[model samples]
Target: MRRMTPARRILLLVAACVFLACTAVPAWRGAKIAYHLHTARYLLGQGELAQALSWLAYPLQEQPRSAEVHYLLGNTYRRQGNFDRALRHLAKARQYGWRREEVDLQVVLIDVQRGDVEAADPLLDRAAVHAVPDDVAVEVYEALAKGYLALHRIEDAMVVLDTWIQWQPRAVQPRLWRARIHERENDWDRAAAEYRQILSVKPDDVPALLGMAGALLARNEPVQALPYFRRCTELAPDPTQAQLGLAQCLRRLGRGAEAGQLIARLLRGSLTLEQQATAHYELGLLALADHRLHAAIRHLQTAVDLAPQHIALRDALAEALEKAGKSRQAASHRQQAERLRQQEDRISRLLAALAESPHNPDLRCDAGDALMQGGYPREAVRWYMNALKIDPEHRRAHESLARYYEAIDMPDLAAEHRQHATQAGAQPQLSKPDQPDGLRGDGPPPTPKACGPVQDQPPLQKLEQRAGPP
Candidate 1:
């Protein structure tokens, strides 16, 4: 071929350049998408959720219809606690060919968190009806159960939990939760049975041991519960609750001297306000058991001071003050108790009025509370069960029934109720109210309660604080 002219040569060069540009553009776009996707994942893993969201925005703009991108974006938003945004993205993902059980479960969670139980219910019902893959089905049911629990629909929670157990029998979480609900319902026997099941699966679970011990003690089998409490202490190494529990068991077994020694040791150490209060309370119990009235009064007084919210502690202090001829102080405590009792009664009456209308499951649960306060736990159980029969997914009913069982020394029944409670998605009970000690005291002690103990040590101070002070 002959040499081309300058103008022709320039045109040929331009054409070649244009072809290369076209090829490179698509490759560059693909590479950019991949980079952003990976960068978003990396940032998410690093806990930089905001940064991950920013990185996701670019790829979503380029590939707005991409299901995977939207799913990832939803996950990031969920992790950041932005349930609304997360639900929006997840809904979009589902709309774009990402219809799966996992996605449905996420939607359920978002709705539950947003307190839109009504919206979540249909989605859960649909997911269950559609028969998604096995793992997805399990997850979906679990999420639904949790949603019901959040709404305090305990019976509904139990049905879902039972479904989960049927699907995955070997899973321990469902069983553990069941036991907890039983504990809440005061079904000691049922709670014990569930705890036993947990112990069978994982022999060294401290929580299960503690729960079992508490159940046994509640059943007036302190001797039987002692070993479990000791085991809990052994496993926990430095568990204050376990220590206190062991001490209580020892006192019940007529080993008050040893229990008192343990209480003294606990008192001498630095402590959290809660621990301090508990230690003083235990010491008071030990002293009272031994008929050391003065010592008991001092310890009980310290406990009341440290935890003003503890009605039992205040009541005990009032009694001790009365015995010691401190009528004025006793009267003050008695007045406080009466006021609190009246307030509780007022709330119970209001709840009862609400329950008089048969349409509200929540109101029924609330009414059960009134019955329980009225010292009719068995009657409360009936109301709770009635609520559950009305709505098998009723959370409050399950919780109330579990507590009732525990109260009646039926651990197995308690466990069954607790299982449903967990399925209903009830939160773990953080603290239990201090119950009454069987003994009485006479006079106060000489020592002033210590304060400002080391952060990591046991408690010594007795600073009065509000209810649920810890």
Candidate 2:
């Protein structure tokens, strides 16, 4: 070999530097895209849809044809109930190397969510026949069951849950859900049997224990319920419900003093509004059993105030008031109770209509309106959320949520929904007429930041070195 000149050596060095640059830039770009994709997936799993959408935007802008990116973007949109955008991205995913088998299940889920179950049926039938991965099978089965229940197709929901159990006998969720359906039908014996099966598999399962106790109590077998409720109280982190059930059983078994003391202790602790109402109701029942009419009336009235929608509480309060010779007060409560019952009936009719026309946002809104009138604002929120899920731009739903969030003192969430309601072309009727629409007047809604701490990324130099100068 000839001895190379310094200039030639320098030329070779320059060429090597150019080659490294060429390889490194693409490698670094690919790594950045991958990082964004992985972060988006994590955010999606965390239920941070807004953050996930932001993260996905980067990879999508960089590699619009990337199959994984398109699939993930499709999922993000699907979760947001932007079904048109979801389907468009999913089509792109299929066009760019994602298999039809993997993509079809998601499409089925979208159809189910959109209340197009008939359109999803053929795809579901195909999925049932094929051997899919266990995770995929679980997701499909769960979605089908939920959709069926939403449509009030009880038999179909049962069939889906039964199939889920048959395929995955060891799975607890399907069995638990099956038991709940039985409970809903008032089949205490069947519910108890299902709970027993779960307890046999996982002896310390608090939900199963609570279910067994509730079923036995419904069957008027407090003797059988006591031990289960006791076990649940021992196992559950928040044993309020279990303790209440235990107290109920004790009172029924002629241990009213013990039950009253347990309830008194429970009332002194921190609890949700619902839990506090239940505790008060139990205490009222104990006082009533002891023939303390005034005490009973006070406790029951407090329960009625806390949970205004509970028919039983109103009736119980009226009963105590009547016993105390306050007939006028009792009559007023009874009339209010009747009005609530009628409103509930209206809500049920609207919900039944929704089952027939599952995608009807107006039906859902009507149900929410009825629930709100009946003083069930929390439950009404769920109905509004359901309406939004079917029709993202439903003005009434956004207006309802804005009012709810404002009442709860969540200004940021309230402002967001208010802005949405405004953009949907309706003037939102704020609960407080003087409340300012900050997002509306302040230019635009604030951008959502990515959730959690930022993860460190490898420098381009390190990534290039790892790729080794293609």
- Which one wins on TM-score? 2
Clashes of each: 50, 0
State the lDDT at 444 in candidate 2. Answer: 31
lDDT tens digits by residue: candidate 1, 1-470: 89899999999999999999999998999899999999998776544567798999989999999998998888778755577788888988989989676587676666653324445545544543343454334334444554555434455456555655654575566677788777766798999998888788878877788888989998989899999988988887456777877888888888888888887787777678888887888788776666677987899989978887577787877877787788999899988887667756664565445423333566667767776775556656656765664456576688778777787799999898789878767555332211112212332211111112123322222223222101
Q: What is the lDDT of residue 407 in candidate 1?
A: 74
In candidate 1, where is summed lDDT lowest over 10 consecutive residues? Answer: 444-453
Model 2 lDDT tens row, 1-470: 99999999999999999999999999999999889988998776544577899998889888888899888888878767688999999999999999887687678778776544445555544544444455554555556666666544555567666655655576666778789988876898899989988888878878889999999999999999999999998888789899989998998899988998998898889888998998889889888878899999999999999998799999999999999999999999999899988986786677556545555677778888887877779778877876776567678899999999999899999999889888877545333211113433434322211111112221000011111000
CA shift at 265, candidate 2, in angstroms? 2.0
| TM-score of candidate 1 relative to the true fold | 0.52
Cα-based RMSD of candidate 1: 20.4
lDDT of each: 0.68, 0.75
